[model samples]
Target: MEILTDYILQFGDLNKQQTDLIASKAKKLDLHKDDYFSEAGKIPKQVGFILEGVFRFCYYNNKGEEITNYFVEEGNFVVDYQKFHTQVIASEYIQAVTDCKILAFSRKDWEDILNTIVGWDKIEAKIYQKCMTQAIERRSPLVSEDATTRYLSFMEEFPKLINRIPLSYVASYLGITQQSLSRVRKNIR
Candidate 1:
């Protein structure tokens, strides 16, 4: 709860009562590796604040190959943001890449906070903007960089996370084949 509240506090100030309200509504969730926190085509029931571990945002491509687009680690929130706001089905999956512990709030509880707490929407907007910025910073380079460059950048940027994750997921996230990733790894070594 402290970790979650600390994260939220970074975006905006919350009085004690408001902070308590959020803490009371939070539910602890534990997800094993490979578990889907939210699935494609399902409406997410809760928005999760990661306390520990990593999650990968992925979807199937036209040829039915799984493609990873983003990785969310601890001290961040995870949800299909657009879908959650509109109460629509998600088009992508948020999957646990490691054994994870999260603090979460149901959609109804989140709405109650938004309705009852002043300035919460502003705080939310700031957090959303931060998430968007981080996403762009992580993803933009992938578009123009060669696969080797992408892999190298991924390593330098996420040294701790890369070792904890499977190379298959790393390859997918880098938009390269496993064989290519292996070749890169070997050549770099």
Candidate 2:
């Protein structure tokens, strides 16, 4: 909760009462490896803040292969805003990459915070902006760069995650096969 408070504080100032309200609304959840936080074809009830471990945003392609869209590590937020805010069923999945501890709050509580707290909308807007920027950074390389270059950029962007996450997931995220990723790694070495 302190980490979440600090993360939010980075974007906007929150009064003690507001911070307390946020902390009160959140609940801790432990997810084991391979557990799904939000699954495909379901409406997500809660927004999760990663307190520990990593998660991947993924979906099955037409070929029935799972494609990793991105990863969320500790000190980050993970919610499919289109589905969560619009109350629609999600087309993608959010799954724990490892055992994870998360702070979750229902959509109702999130709305309550938005309505009750002053300047929260501004803070949320900034958070969404950051999320958008990150999405762009993660996707743009796939369109313009070679697989090896994309892997290099991934290393640069997520230096801490390379060793923590599975290489298969990283290869999927880079739009390359696991063998290709191995070759890239070998070449780099």
Candidate 3:
């Protein structure tokens, strides 16, 4: 709960009453490795904050291959925002890659909090902006950068990700085959 308070304090000050109100609406969840917080085609009811461990956003392509889109580590928020906001079924899945603990708030509860809390709207807007910027940066490299360059950049940005995630998923995100990723690693080593 203190983690939630810390996160809120980053955006604005919350008195004890306000903090308690928000905390009361949040639910704690524990997930095993490979457990899905939200699956494709399901309407996601809650947005989650990672208390521990890692989660990945993924989807299958036409060929039925899973493609990793984003990795949310501890101290981050995990939500399929488009579906959560629109009340539509999500196209992707949010899954735990390691045993995880999370604090989750229902969409309705979040909306209520936003309406009642001063300066919350601005905080939410900044969050959305960061999400969008990350998406743009990811797509830009795939569209314009060569494989080696992309691989190098990925290592520079998230060197630990290669060791943390499965090679297949990392390769998929890099738009390369696992063998290629292996070669890239070898080259770098």
On the 0 to 100 scale, the lDDT of residue 153 in model 2 is: 93
Best by lDDT: 1
Candidate 2 runs further than 4 Å off: none
**Model 2 per-residue lDDT tens digits across residues 28-104:** 99999989999999998888899999999999999999999989899988888779988999999999999999999
Candidates 2 and 3 compared by lDDT, better number: 2
**Model 2: lDDT of residue 130:** 94
The Cα RMSD of model 3 versus the native structure comes to 1.9
What clash pairs does model 3 have? none
Question: lDDT by residue for model 1 over 109-165, one digit each (tens)?
Answer: 999999999999999999999999989999999899998899989987787797889
- Any runs in candidate 1 off by more than 4 Å, and if so which? none
Ranking of candidates on TM-score, top first: 1, 2, 3
C-alpha positional error of residue 97 in candidate 2 after TM-score superposition, expressed in Å: 0.7
RMSD of each: 0.9, 1.0, 1.9
Clashes of each: 0, 0, 0
Scored against the true structure, residue 73 in model 1 reaches a CA lDDT of: 93
Q: Kindly indicate the candidate among 1 and 2 with the higher TM-score.
A: 1
TM-score of each: 0.97, 0.96, 0.89
